[model samples]
Target: MRHILVHLDSGERTAVRLALATELATRFGARVTALFAQSDRYGPGIVARRAGPALEEAAAAAKAAAEAACAAAGVACEWWQLLHGERNHVVAETVICARYADLAVFGQYDPAGDAPVPEDLVEQVILNSGRPVLVVPAAGSYATVGRRALVAWNGSREAARALGDSMPFLAGADAVTVLSLRGAVESSVAGRVPPVDIAAHLASHGVTAEVDLVPPNEAGVTNMILNRGADLASDLLVMGAYGNYGFPFGLRGSNTRNILREMTMPVLFAH
Candidate 1:
């Protein structure tokens, strides 16, 4: 909500991440921290030594653009550089930076991009940061966000956390939908507390939400959630990043991974 931390790299979609961060900062009256993190392939070779300056220049350019965008939007901004030294891991460093913010913004993974960021950067941050993360899609332009929202609920602890973390957006949304997947719900408590409980909870926060009790889709839960978001024309999707035990939440869960891979709109995820 406030204290927005956005991850930026030399990737082409860095602007998209900054745009979303600025929009959220303007909406919530928050300060933006643009963290420029890219792996530095430092070594003793001449080519490796030359790559360092290029990376530094790229980081400087990203920082300047982030500051300029924030200034034009009348939002306070801070810049941070997380350098990946020979012994440092980019994912761990990024997660460390994300810990101090209320929400972290990131661009969806682009397999085609030449960005030096680790492929699992976003996933690691979400699992370790203990904060909500909003990921902007890498391919499209989202001029509007958090206006029309879709929340996927399965009554798990992760789902509850996601719902609570997304209260700010839901409370301000023009329309909100809570998609309760029946099969995913615990059978004992399935019929007892339906999506109405969630709707009522949102109502208490001034977020009027309509509930849809959907059965298990033959296709898959992930596809079902994405299809519902597209059908509802939602600008944001809120969901829990379910993970296996002995670790954090389920960023490794297929549902979470699939959704992140095929997401068409921004997704707000919590563990």
Candidate 2:
């Protein structure tokens, strides 16, 4: 990854993702661009301080934090902002910036927190920017990511794209598990590529990967994936961005919304 674009806001988790982006940049010799944005809609979070000096103060603090972190890490860093724009414009600006970077880092939506950005910002950027997005959970201390990765494999084009996009992480991980839903493979088909094939591909790249299968539960595929990620104690989860073009995306088969809502580990998503 040459360039990493991370979203920054007034929320406390800005430090968490900024730390993550700095770590990745140092690891891969990449530059980090901190994009600070705010939503104009009046709702939970910092929307109440939409007008006046308080908002400007918050934005300044966020920018300063990023600058300090990047300076301490000794990585090339740039600052961008969209301080006076509507909610849609904030999301649009973020997406446009992410399109220029190899990977975009975002924080998962916290329904209970006072988020200064749109709740669907991460989803919109991932699905629209044509870039791999790494979403850090809003509540977690991820000092290290991608050491142990759990990849959700469903034999779809989207899944293939995600696997390809996560090569950097996979090649660096100590262990990787290609987790597939039970009965999700076409073992009988002559030209079909199964999870074992995926493992072989990773092996060719010098990444040791194991193939595992799990049955879907009443809670659904997203729950099953999260459960396994917890079981493996993985720091990163690699999956495809399965969703429509708009918000409230009803993803086919697995619900992208549910994954976004319930994901605890940092997930790298590509469409």
Q: Write the per-residue lDDT of candidate 2 for residues 1-271, one digit (tens) a residue.
A: 8999988888888989999999999999999999887774442245542444655667789889999999999999999877454677788878898999999999998878776677788888988899999999878799879999999876667778888999999999988998864243453453665335677788889999988865433235677778888999999999877733211223562467778888889999988
Q: What TM-score, computed on C-alpha atoms, does each candidate reach?
A: 0.89, 0.87
Clashing pairs in 2: 45-114
Model 2 has a clash total of 1
Error of 2 at 260 (Å): 0.7
Off by over 4 Å in 2: 41-52, 185-196, 215-219, 243-254
Give the best candidate by TM-score.
1
TM-score of 2: 0.87
Q: In candidate 1, where is summed lDDT lowest over 10 consecutive residues?
A: 243-252
Error of 2 at 200 (Å): 1.0
lDDT of each: 0.81, 0.80
Q: Across residues 85-189, which tens digit of lDDT does each residue of candidate 1 receive?
A: 332456777889999999999988888877866678888888889999999987999866889999988777788899999998988999999987645445545
